[model samples]
Target: MDTAPARDSAPPRTTAADARRGAPASRRPVLPYLLIAPTVLALAVVLGYPLAGLLLLSFQDMTRRELFSGAAPPWAGADNYRTVLTDGFFWEVLARTLLFTLVCVGVTMALAVPVALLMRRVDPWLRAVMAGVLVAVWAMPVMVAASVFRWLSDADDGVLNWLLGLLPGVDLDKHNWFYDPWQGFAVIAGVVVWGALPFAVLTLEAALTQVPRELAEAAVLDGANARQLFRHVTLPVIRPALVLVTALLAIGCTGVFNEIWLLRGGRPESDYYLLGVYSFIESFAVNRYSTGAAISVITVLLLLGGAVVYVRRLRALGEIE
Candidate 1:
């Protein structure tokens, strides 16, 4: 007992050394912000500066002369916004935009989900080939897609008409696809959906692959069929991906200018005019710089709202998990 007390009286050398060793490790200087600096700087230059300038211009009644001649433009208050709201044609254009976005998004998601599911079940080699095709579609230049489709939809010697001619009892000469508003809209929506589907498929397919195999196996063992498994298990697991892809698709669809511009044969007065087309026409054609700026600001706000809703949904889904 006496010896034990003597040993306890000795200084705890190893403990002191251990505490000394841990002090440096625990007080390690953190510089995580350095890694994210480049991303923050890029966003500031690319998105932030332009966005700020656009918002400021939206409130000014700036003509082309005022913009280019360095003269200060008078304030417009809500005048530009009022013009957009009060004009019957503006309301009509807005309605068309909403309808087109909803229809195209609905169709794209409807087609893409089933296709993604099928691709998941396919052999790896075949899946790779399918992904390659989608990548090719995605990699096509937006302008190039529009140009090719324009050539196909031409009234003379167009491939679409050429193919229609081969169908039994098909009337080839009745419709000018780009002439009527509804016809033009159909073509536009179709082209937009095709362009957007590749991204949707790619995103959802990756999500499908992330689904745990054991969950699927358990479902199968419990007499769950393919449809049941997807409905109950797979969908819940991939809901976040679906939300993200939907947001991306919506953002892309909301700013559909190039395809509509080309499909309208670059007509300024085409009924397919949305905010995107309106902004371009205002800036370059009509020289309504303030109006163009306002439209751009609105489009950006709409996209941001959609993105926020998407992220919130994703967060809520994650919490339930």
Candidate 2:
């Protein structure tokens, strides 16, 4: 009898999915993380170091002497923080900053929503023209825009005064816009809103374009009026974008510096002191680097707290994972 040799059983072949399932749950793909490592490292070096330095500086008593002489400053622990928190003026500035930011964000959103909706309804050519104009305005340098606005509101020979002089009995010739803090802030707010509109309008319009046409048409067919359709459908679709724009505007307005500094001729009065301007005045004008750093830290903490609150709210609403 011929007996065939026993054939050795071949090992079972494993597919990628099978191997993945067999792998430890903690094991993740390394290539994606490796690819992003350089960027993360660069940002840490660029941003993290400065932030760390600021924190350290806030704890010390750094003066102009230490700055120019390259000598280590004396440690002051929490003195800077104590000084700022105890000052009534600091509270006023903080309150002013918050109120101003709220107003700017409110006005920007109010104007942006309508403009974006109008762009959606307008002819394509008109939309393109409007977009181009907005882009041009957005591209304008802040300094140049501020200078032009200054000239327009100049005490002598201003186009705005000239135009206002034409009104029935409103003589605004030789008007000093910066003399009154309220009027000065209004002008600054106008400039801020004008510069901000392009980005807000464009972002909202882009979000609007992502809205499902079928859903809108279905809502219209279901007897939903224009207001109802927007409230029920359009608003939900663009809510995320609106929130993002509003947050950014609030942060920007809170840190407003360039416009106020330029408009006030680089010497903002007590009435015009926002947080950023106050910090600048403390650091450079008064040579209190430690106090400035402390203020900067406080501003950062406030912003971070706001961000955390917004994130939690969104998560609670099931808007984010």
lDDT of 2 at 262: 90
What is every candidate's alpha-carbon RMSD to the true fold?
A: 6.8, 6.2
| Candidate 2: clashing pairs of residues | none
Query: Mind giving the per-residue lDDT tens digits that candidate 1 earns over 1-321?
Result: 345443446664656446545547556555657888899999999989989988888889998678679998999998887776677876677677777888889999999999999898899999999999999998998788888887777778678877887899987764577777787787788789889999999999999988999999999999999899989999998888888887888888888888888776688465778879988888779888888888788788878888878877876775322
What TM value does model 2 have?
A: 0.88
RMSD over all Cα atoms, model 2: 6.2
The runs of at least 3 residues in candidate 2 whose Cα sits more than 4 Å from the true structure, single-residue gaps closed, are 1-32, 317-319
Q: List, residue by residue over 87-180, the lDDT tens digit for candidate 2.
A: 9999999999998888888999999999999999999999999999999999998888888888888889778889989999998977998899
lDDT of each: 0.83, 0.90
lDDT of 2 at 192: 88
Clashes by residue pair, model 1: none
Most TM-score-accurate candidate: 2
